[model samples]
Target: MAAGEPQAKKLKLEPKQLSENVLFGMGNPLLDICAVVDKDFLDKYGLKPNDQILAEEKHKELFEELVKKFKVEYHAGGSTQNSVKVAQWMIQSPYKAATFFGCIGKDKFGEILKKKAEEAHVDAHYYEQSEEPTGTCAACITSDNRSLVANLAAANCYKKEKHLDLEKNWKLVEKAKVYYIAGFFLTVSPEAILKVATQASANNKIFSLNLSAPFISQFYKEPMMKVMPYVDVLFGNETEAATFAREQGFETEDIKEIAKKTQALPKVNTKRQRIVVFTQGKDDTVMATANEVTTFPVLVSDQSEIVDTNGAGDAFVGGFLSQLVYDRPVTECIRAGHYAASVIIKRSGCTFPEKPDFH
Candidate 1:
């Protein structure tokens, strides 16, 4: 306690800067080629509705021939890409998205996807794989804008060794207030998830995970277990939640028991600071956190007219993270998520809601 004899300088560490409204998404970036076709088109190709067919070289050639027989359109899409797009639109703010993937050809489709990201006001930082073609998901639509078949390609090449740019972009993950990741990416490359999760956790950054598809859970059980401790918020539908619960020895029918088990799962690395939100189709959403569990009713739309349900879950994550980045109350975050999902359900694709009238 020296008074005036060259007092030692006191050092203070500055608090981490958190973005108020910016949201960051990490996943595959692909183009969605939406083709509106009639029954004749399906009959011509012996294709069934609501089926996702994998395309190889022969299948891709056949698809090209079929496209020549029918009219089609294109949009920028990817599970996480759609999430960031909706977030920017709903919040009407500058949101940033960083994707890790590699593509073989530097073609127009790739350029267009990058342009679309810019147009959506999302900061795009992608690593091109000089060996593989860019990934795409062909969504065949009916006259009513209902999707029939979703052909996923190029997205399969999202591997770990190809994404060395991730190291360069580690700063993006660290600087982000909230990091949104899709489960599909984890299924494709679990090491990428570990890298991002470890960095985000070390920086004390908020982390959110989307169960992009139910089938992904089947393939990603071990990887999911490894990253669960780093996750702070989890987004998934009833099917995905039930699958995860079953893995933990809970029955699907006993949703309450499932929720309890979900809440009680041990953190993988650090102290438990997590929330699990289980969304059911038009049913009440069940949320479980460490200290509390609750349900939030879904905002019902007129049953007469329902649109595509493609990116509803992604929109919900974006809305939830939008509020969470600002450190808003958990209740408000839930409400905002519900509102975003409602808007997307009323549209065809991963459309965003109107500017949030924050009450």
Candidate 2:
């Protein structure tokens, strides 16, 4: 033993916490440029309320108009990033609790996104791609509706071989007890998603998935189905669940029927049955497992109290995943999800309150 050597201190986690208790997420990363606009503004720009459309070069004019005419706010955004941020906010551990990975350009927007994520207590592992500019998502919010237009420039540069093949990165992936990937990534890197899902299954980690949109469920069914067998917990909104069911050749949009079929899908390596949970806006939320189905009514919130619905579902996933990592019951997990969603809807553009009161 060398007497002059510096010693590293051991981190002592709680009894319930382990090396694998950390959460890791992967998806496109975007700098959310959010502003309030009128329905007329949407019509002028040819945008449909509540629809998320990928931005093209032609949409640059609309973005310029937004920045010129409205009050704009920027935040680190993307479905997976939002969920990971909320999970970090809920978990509240001094050591790293949640980590996210994606691609970003070597530009100002990329720098801003990474800084904001660190401020939210999330470990931001972003790759800097030089070929394109940083990505941005413009969110147009109205009194009762929101529309998103995304320009995924460098965000789509993440590749399985260049990013995920690094030995150091693979070590980090193997250490996570839980993993989450937004469905949007299926279009960009289904290979990476499959690799992570396979690893989670082999190691008995909880792998979660969010059906990002109805279009993804309807169009990207094949890749999603390949990964579903490895998913331990699955989330979707009513529209996504229905769309997935119909695309899979089911005859009904009934959530229970959808859940039953989803739950019956084969699982890999996991001994416990898969769980399917879908939320129906303002209606009862349903959860189905191999054994039974349970439904809980959405906690009532006045229409006037709801300010923005931009990141409500992402917040719910964050809350639920935080609880699930701690091995909470499904009912408690759903309650935590609802609580978090309730808090987010009162704010604008995926922003959180001062502190999350989970108690």
Looking at model 1, how many pairs of residues clash?
7
Give the TM-scores of the predictions, in the order they appear.
0.81, 0.93
Instruction: Count clashes in each candidate, considering only residues at least 3 apart in sequence or on different chains.
Output: 7, 0
Q: Once superposed on the true structure, which residue ranges of model 2 sit more than 4 Å away at CA? A: 1-15, 18-21
- For candidate 2, list the clashing residue pairs, or say none: none
lDDT of 1 at 60: 55
- Over 291-336, each residue of candidate 2 has an lDDT whose tens digit, in order, gives 8989988778899999888888899899898888788899988998
Measure candidate 2: CA RMSD.
5.1
Which predicted model would earn the best TM-score? 2
TM-score, structure 2 vs. true: 0.93
Candidate 1's C-alpha runs over 4 A off are 1-22, 36-66, 69-71, 95-105, 141-154, 158-167, 268-272, 353-359
Per-prediction CA RMSD (Å): 7.5, 5.1
- Give the candidate number with the greatest lDDT: 2
lDDT of 2 at 176: 86
